[model samples]
Target: MASRDEVECWLTDMDGVLVHENHALPGAAALLQQWQDQGKPFLVLTNNSIFTPRDLSARLRSSGLDVPEEFIWTSALATADFLKSQVPGGSAFVIGEAGITTALHEAGFIMTETDPDYVVVGETRNYSFEAITKAIRLIVNGARFIVTNPDATGPSADGPLPATGAIAALITKATGKEPYVVGKPNPMMFRSAMNRIGAHSENTAMIGDRMDTDIVAGIEAGLHTILVLTGISDQAEIERYPFRPDEILQGVHELVENDPFLAEIND
Candidate 1:
């Protein structure tokens, strides 16, 4: 793997690396500004498919991170991109919020209930039983199943709530069919993000907090991977994974502190 200095493009997980619970982490804003000033190609990546890129960008802004909509990549967008490539202007029976719906619409996909080409599932707070029933029936009848991510649960103030993977599992139990997931842990997400920034894996770096999803996917995509302890995984957790990230740090603050480019700029 190439050293951090050799990297020309960067992809970082949003929740852990930059923000947590709607608040920007230490040095997150400065790091983004540094990248912008240096003309570095970078993107903020998320497995969450509940909100559109515009919505995510605004949320980041609220957290004091100035990431633009175009610089944010979600699993929703990657799913739409994958499906668009598979079947241009295809139709799907979708169970999701504006994120997945908007992406599919922009990709020329027709959203319908009857005899759709695929049954696409994404993240939503309101998972209707009726909608799930329709999805199950459609999948049982023959529509291909697709899920935005494999995350079984999402963090909430109360506790962990059912996510796309959990719903997908329910549908699978009823229909006996597994969904083709298109999010983190699947290198396709990174590849699509890299393609968006016109970055090659050899010259790209990925920053994430989780070993199972972010780090593993980065390694599979052939990009330099950095793991931060700000969210989810820590030193002990890192040892659990057979593979390891290229670098591990306390948080984004350390990343900004150690950056040679930022040092040169300060000098």
Candidate 2:
């Protein structure tokens, strides 16, 4: 693994490492500013495919983080990238919002219901029964199944809401065909983000809060991994995972205050 000082690019989870509940975490602003001031290559990543990069950037601005749309990468973008590579100018029957649709459109993918190349599913609050039924029928008829993420549930003020994974399971049961997930824990998401920044695995670092998704994917991608305690994974939870991150901290604040990478930049 690359040491902190050797790292030249960064990939960080958005919700846990930088913001939570639409609020920027401690040192989150400082860390981002420091990266920008030094012209460091970095990208904020998320599994949520409900919002476009522009939408996420505005949301981060509302949280007091000045991340731009180009600096943000989402599962939808990665999925689009993958599909474009596999089948240029392909078509898909999609069940998602502007995030997924816009990305596919930008990739030159056609959105159609008739004998599409793939059945793409993403995160959305409104999971219409009719839409899901159509997706199932298409998959059964030989359309390839693809999902943005494997998150079974998403957090909300009320309770856990069914997410892409849950819906994917339903479709899988009906069609007896599993989807190719293109988000965290798959390592393809991190690789796609790195490719966007022209970063190599040997010199890239990933900072995240979840042991299962972020840390595991970082390790699989061969990037330096740092686990923070501000979100889902706790010390006890870390033990449950067989693998471990290279470093652990209370939050991004510690990186802002004492990271050797920042010190090297100042020097």
Count of backbone collisions in candidate 1: 0
TM per candidate comes to 0.95, 0.96
| Cα error, candidate 1, residue 120 (Å) | 0.5
Q: Pick out the ten consecutive residues of candidate 1 with the lowest summed lDDT.
A: 257-266
lDDT of 2 by residue, 60-150 (tens): 9999999999999999999999999999999999999999999999999999999999999999999999999999999999999999999
What's the lDDT for all of these models?
Answer: 0.94, 0.95
Task: Report the lDDT tens digits of candidate 1 across residue range 136-253.
Answer: 9999999999999999999999999999999999999999999999999999999999999999999999999999999999999999999999999988899998999999987887
| Cα lDDT over the full model 2 | 0.95
